[model samples]
Target: MSCTTAHAHELYQLYASHLIKRDIWDVKRSVMEQRFQFDPFAPQISCAGIHEHHKILDDLGDEMVVINQAYTRLWPAAQRDCTYLTSRRRVDDTDIYAVINYSVNHPDDHIPASFVRASAEVGMVCESVIRPQCTETSLDALTRQDIQTKIYYQAKISPGGWVPAAVVRETSKREYPKFLHQLGKGCTEHFSDRPLDCSTVKKAFESRPPPAE
Candidate 1:
């Protein structure tokens, strides 16, 4: 049989098992071509193909594992205390929320305010099976005017009761490196038949751990 668009959906396994499992979302993935042949898990980015493409995981048991793994790798980290300033919701009932933290360029200089904007877009996420109401979420708009930093919406996701997940920095003993390492391993040994998106890894922000004591 011809291997052209003729294979089962199989991912790189390494990306989700390590590196990108957690950092995938924040990372800015390049425009990935749809994996139509030889792989079933590839997404349909075009308007017409979107609805049908998103339904890749509807009833298939094998594909469900792929979506679940994607979900875990995509969740943001917990809030921190010492460096953390505050956390609040942007809107009611919606999965969108914002977390603010204090940081500085140098010790002498006062820490500038940093905020993380998060939301599950609702209709944009690609699935083996399409959900009724869904939109992809992504880093829609990131604005920085002098000191102001605003990250608008991007791709959407299912609102799986997603809330503001947080952990205070100073209070939290775990360091950034430690967290990054763990974050990379979002799915552990859970394997999937999905190709790895290099764009996703390239676009991720640099993870910085706190200074050594």
Candidate 2:
């Protein structure tokens, strides 16, 4: 997990752009096409309280049609297409985001004979809270910088051909942490409103001790 001063909405926008915007895929050197079938926040819903916001999110669901092409060392280059159900919800002070493949098919979507059909599930939660700081003098007042958002992310993906589960597991173990570090650096840059030295951030995250098993 990582902490940032960015608000939940800012982080949500970042995540949404990465998934929905075509330019982001281009930056990653992947071919992607996305069409939105449904959008819960299309008109941008507004609510007065936290409970109302949560209820609106639960009631309205978003759906998208996607086609992606990529190459990986563990598998041959292939294209996959699928429809996904995407959602964002607020629970108390925490914001949750999720995307899962839907069984429904879009008439316009077709996979080539050489391509592999794949599916994935992703979820992330961000909690906003005041983090206490250690100081020489005993004080209770919290500074603006003390307010932080904590993020947790999880993803389950299948390449859908004959790829071994062991290979997938090992790949995730090596790649997921790197993804998190990049995300942390992104959040820090957004929060600070300035670009940070990549080497400094890399060293900081890499030097941290591993999580307890």
Per-structure clash totals for the candidates: 50, 0
lDDT of 2 by residue, 54-154 (tens): 00111121323232323222224354443334444555322323433233334545556765655545566665443444121212332335445567765
Which parts of model 1 are misplaced by more than 4 Å? Answer: 1-12, 18-159, 162-176, 182-213
Alpha carbon lDDT of each predicted model = 0.23, 0.37
Write down the worst ten-residue block by lDDT for model 2: 47-56
Candidate 1, residues 104-197: lDDT per residue as tens digits? Answer: 1223222123322222221111111112222322222211110111223222221222222222212123332443344234433242344433
In angstroms, the error of model 2 at 189 is: 2.2
Quote model 1's TM-score.
0.18
> Model 1 RMSD to the real structure?
24.1
Candidate 2 colliding pairs, count: 0
**Model 2, residue 176: displacement in angstroms?**
2.0
Stretches > 4 Å off in candidate 2: 1-13, 16-75, 92-104, 134-144, 194-213
